[model samples]
Target: MEQAVPSSSLEQSPLQQVQARIAQAARIAGRKAEDVTLVAVSKTKPAEAILALIAQGQRVFGENRVQEAQAKWPDIRTAHPEVALHLVGQLQSNKAEDAIALFDCIHSVDRPSLVTALGKAQDRLGRKVPCFVQVNIGAEDQKGGCAVADLPALLEQARSAGIEVIGLMCVPPADIESAPFFALLDKLADDSGLPCLSMGMSGDFEVAVQLGATHIRVGSALFGER
Candidate 1:
């Protein structure tokens, strides 16, 4: 008879599970898993948890709140200087400066005014922080993103301001699968000449990847429940 394995030996760590998921998604997309970045959404997760993930070779992470990030940044930076941090959530006008200082990328540039504010902040910091134009693909009232029709004009304005518009980002309504939303963003990216598409999360990332997601913002799947 085969010996039974212990639970401790069988259990996968959060980071391992995340890497597996990324690999699976990439396989479905016909792309290498290394080609897609997994931005571990570390918003409210503890410092220890983040460190544990870092120890497992997960480098990129995303955070939602500026204040929460501010509380976590010092230690995370000190311990993992190579880690790339992204602000994947909404940026308040008041926190734009702090966000620019903390994140390598801000993935939620939804409004024209926010773009202007980020441009000013980037100028002050003397660094062109990469960013994504958030699109409300589902047209949900509560979400913050530029309307689909406004994207072209917005990209044009951003280009003229010298802001490096690297890609498009969006969050589909809670009930929607990410395929359609991601496909729409992919179309928009094709039209705008941008290359990156930031979509997908814990529940729908597989769909996002198959639809051509270059960057996926995965949360609970990596960190396990908020």
Candidate 2:
């Protein structure tokens, strides 16, 4: 396991590098770098590291597992009360209720039943939370996402069920350039009237931004490998 850096060192260490990447991406996109939200994927990473990033003004974060997040959320929330947490990993139906209680956004929702589950969970929680339609743009059998053709109907169903489908999320094939997949998601979000496109990661965020990614999920690139 990786130990967390002390607050002082973490505050000074990697923030400049993160800011530079965001600046470069924004320049390429012709948008202010400040407009792009960077979500540090913090799964398996210690809470102290999260505090270091929060000290540098990074607010949004992504977690891959509900259990891991549950373990970290309250402690981390005590450290940074305003941080936005996104569920960027596969969500099991059994865990939907708990996820609804934690995440500010669910980024890997592909099934209709999951959407229904979220709606019911939100009703119980008495809040409307934003969601993303995960698209398996790579069409990988091992991946979790809706078929590209089914997104329209899924969005419609989501809207009617009181779950807001705000955009799309995808993990492209490792060997393929991410721009095409990002473009496909951009087209879908635009055509569907969803303004946010949550795509890309530490590896190919530059390509994602050029292709109109509104939010980026970066892990190793920002916090180093877990």
Candidate 3:
């Protein structure tokens, strides 16, 4: 993994390089770079790495587990007080409250049970997290997204439960052309009236930007090998 380097500005660091790529992609797609939010996937990276990026003005970060973020982020947030943490992994229904307590946004609300759990947690804690309903865009059996057909029902359930679903998220089948999957997600978001899309990663993010991805989760590209 690339060691986090302090004082790395937008001109030469890996983070800056990724940001530049996103901007170039957006420009090529006729969209403004500022509209595409780059969520640095900081899962498993140490606090030093996170703090280094923070010093570089990276306020948005993503984590795979609530427990991990809880352990490392409280002190960091207490110090910076402006960081936005997002949960970008499969979240168990039982962990809804914990997820809500730490993450400002959640990108894995895929089932009715999870929606119900999150709803109760929100009501009890008075904390509302902007959510993204992950879509099994490739129909992969092993993936964690909601099947394409079930999205509408699940979204309705979230609406009834007062969960704020902000967008659609997906992990396309690996080792294949991701554009089709990204394009499909864009269409699904349009049909569902969602304004944002959290698609793309280290490999296919530029394609995702061209296809209307509002948020891209880039991990290895920014932090190096996991």
Candidate 4:
């Protein structure tokens, strides 16, 4: 059995602040606060930061790298059985099996090969992990998401491969107004009949929530600058 972290209000403040913001944003959107799930992005941060948030009662967290998450999370999850892990970074088809065994949700299913790999891994593991198709909403050449025009076909492939796609994900180009991009993702998700929208980060989560984000990947706001 794993021991829980010792509690402290000071240590819990960051999580509280982010949660409050989520609630506020949800209200502004005329949506229930409970409808939004906050995935505290924990990539590149130390285990202590995660432990602190765990102590603060945060159970869902996001990681960017499979290897880094593999290095830290097993021990942490051993201590906290209820925790849910999400993969919020680009995924390679070769890493499908490892990722299927580790993450509860995969937020970067962008291409057909990766989709097929994840499908095979899920069948082998006997555990179907929910996925979110990442859309290149801004059409940035450097991003990992699929082109907006390619989403429908990619989604069809994921479904054909027996992958359960629950939502859509995106990382808008940095240092720009993200509201329009967020709105675009929401529309795309709606058009695709996806029930969840995994948008927003530490900086613009509130705007994202206002624009209908179902899952907000917040890092610095909850764990403080890594």
Better of 2 and 3 by lDDT: 3
Off by over 4 Å in 3: 1-11
Tens digits of per-residue lDDT, candidate 2, 110-153, equal 99899888888889888777999999888889989999989888
| Tens digits of per-residue lDDT for model 4, 1-226 | 9977756534648888788778888988899988999998999998998998898888899999999999999999999989999999999999999999999999999998999899999999999999999999889999999999999999999999999999999999899999999999988999999999999999999999999999999998877776
| Greater-TM-score candidate between 1 and 4 | 4
Candidate numbers sorted by TM-score from highest down: 3, 4, 1, 2
TM-score of 1: 0.93
Residue 11, candidate 3: alpha-carbon lDDT: 47
Largest lDDT belongs to which candidate?
A: 3
Per-residue lDDT tens digits for candidate 1, residues 98-186, read: 98888899899888788778888888988888889999999989999999999988888877767888999999989755677788889
2 against 4, candidate with superior lDDT = 4
Q: How displaced is residue 200 in candidate 2, in Å? A: 0.9
The TM-score of predicted model 4 comes to: 0.93
How high is each candidate's TM-score? 0.93, 0.92, 0.95, 0.93
lDDT score for candidate 1 against the true structure: 0.86
**What does the lDDT read for residue 93 in candidate 4?**
94
lDDT: worst 10-residue window of model 1: 6-15
Cα deviation of 47 in candidate 4 (Å)?
Answer: 1.7
